[model samples]
Target: MPLHKVININSSTTIFLWKITESFEDLFDEVQLKDINLIRLNTMKSELHQRGFLSVRKLLSHCGYTDFDLIYDQSGKPYLEDGKHISISHSHEFSTIVLSDQNIGIDLELVKEKVLRIAPRFMDISHLDNLSEQDQMKKATIIWGIKEAVFKLKNEVGISFTDHIFEDPFLLSDKKGTAKLRFNEGVEQFTIVFEEIENYMLVCALKDE
Candidate 1:
């Protein structure tokens, strides 16, 4: 019931976010899950993860769907029975889903200092130049979300964040930018939109036409 935010990205696309404040039992009692997801949920050792999983179902309900309408490919990408594109992400107390008529990806990440330390492993360090340490962490977190969003959008093997996905340089104030995925002798572009949600960064990538 803690629907934190809803973003109408366009007439055909929307993003839903939930702030997890319910007990696992409460969430479990509220949402109905398919047999496969029920088994998968029981296998999750962490209650936090279980809550995140259940919370996604709750978000689906808001969009007028259920676990029955959601399907996952062998590559672990999610799809809707109605044939709309779907992407999901969860971080700490937050979970998000982007539903669109076009191919899209969404990611929610906590703005942690650790992302700055690992910046070199996943992003172009030059993008972090001329920024304070605080800004660096925020920017790095956004870039990480950018790569994750792109990966989810591609949902292909051998797409390395550091090696294949590239985010265009942009200031944090921009709130939106672009990225490219170069792999398998082809290049694809995506428009990236992001926002800071409390202590988390929420990013969504829509494939360029």
Candidate 2:
């Protein structure tokens, strides 16, 4: 399928989402990959992942970019040649990219029952209190994405989801929240926005400035 959705988070930030319905060959034939990325693509063992990677390239094309315009830093954070900050994420059959003039991170997660089972490990379990099992799963997934997106934005080592990131309680209906990163003797605030996309949670984090 073509670009599934385009979300204008603000005047300066935008998100593009793609539903991965094409086979690996279809995606690979559509996008040109840099030599290094070509090797990385071929080395991937999972075909689903390969398709996801190429799907990201397809998304780049939608934004008037190619694989050559996308580069990664030493910490494996992606950036655009035009000096825009970009964050990439793919889960199950969905892939998304968010671009902003400011620091940003994004995460896409398929809602699953397993998140509730392990909620205690990474989040404040009290946040899940008094919610239905289904709601618990969705909230847990959102919190996990919150931590993951924050980590991607920071891209620093030794940041633990359970230890360094804290998410404020929010109802599933709110569709937005806030979090704090208490690391390196500093406290950084983030504004979080999320949405439900066909049983998947698409979460974005931006530095509160």
Candidate 3:
């Protein structure tokens, strides 16, 4: 019942976030999962993951859908039976989903100093220059979320975060930017938006038409 936030990105897109605070039994009793998901849920070894999975179902209900109306591709990307695009993400105590009429991707990540340590692996570290350590961690986490969102949007084989995706330079205060995917002998662009949610960063990528 901890429906944390609902963001109306546009007329056709919205994001829902849930702060996981319910016990496993409480969530399990509330969400009616499909047989496959039930089996899959039972197989999760981590209780946090189980809670995250169940929390997503709570978000689905908020959007007027159910487990029965959702399906996943061979790549494990989730989609809506009504043909609306959907993307999901969770980390630690939070879970989020973005439902849009257009192809879109979203990511939720906890801000941590660890991301600053791995910044070079997936982003242009120059973007982090001139910022204090705290700001750097926040910006790095946002960049990581940008790459993850783009990856979910692409959902292709052989896409390396470091080798394939590139985020353009933007101020952390801007809260939105652009990125490019250079792969398969073609270039595609995406509009990126992000916001700070408590101690976590929430990012969304919308494929350019």
lDDT measured at residue 68 in model 3 versus the true structure, 0 to 100: 98
Off by over 4 Å in 1: none
TM-score of 2: 0.99
Model 1 per-residue lDDT tens digits across residues 8-122: 8889999999999999999999999999999999999999999999999999998899999999999899999999999999987999999999999999999988898899999
TM-score of every candidate relative to the true structure? 0.98, 0.99, 0.98
Measured with C-alpha atoms, the lDDT of residue 9 in candidate 3 is 85
Ten-residue segment with the worst summed lDDT in candidate 3?
Answer: 1-10
Q: Using TM-score as the measure, name the better of candidate 2 and candidate 3.
A: 2
Model 3, 1-209: lDDT tens digits are 56899998889999999999999999998989999999999999999999999999999998899999999999899999999999999998999999999999999999988997788888889998999999999999998999999999989999989999999999989989999999999999999999999999999999899
Error of 3 at 41 (Å): 0.6
Total clashes, candidate 1? 0
Model 2, which residues run further than 4 Å from truth?
none
Q: 142-180, model 2: which lDDT tens digit per residue?
A: 999999999999999999999999998788999899999
lDDT of 1: 0.94
Q: How accurate is candidate 2 locally (lDDT)?
A: 0.95
Summed backbone clashes in each candidate are 0, 0, 0
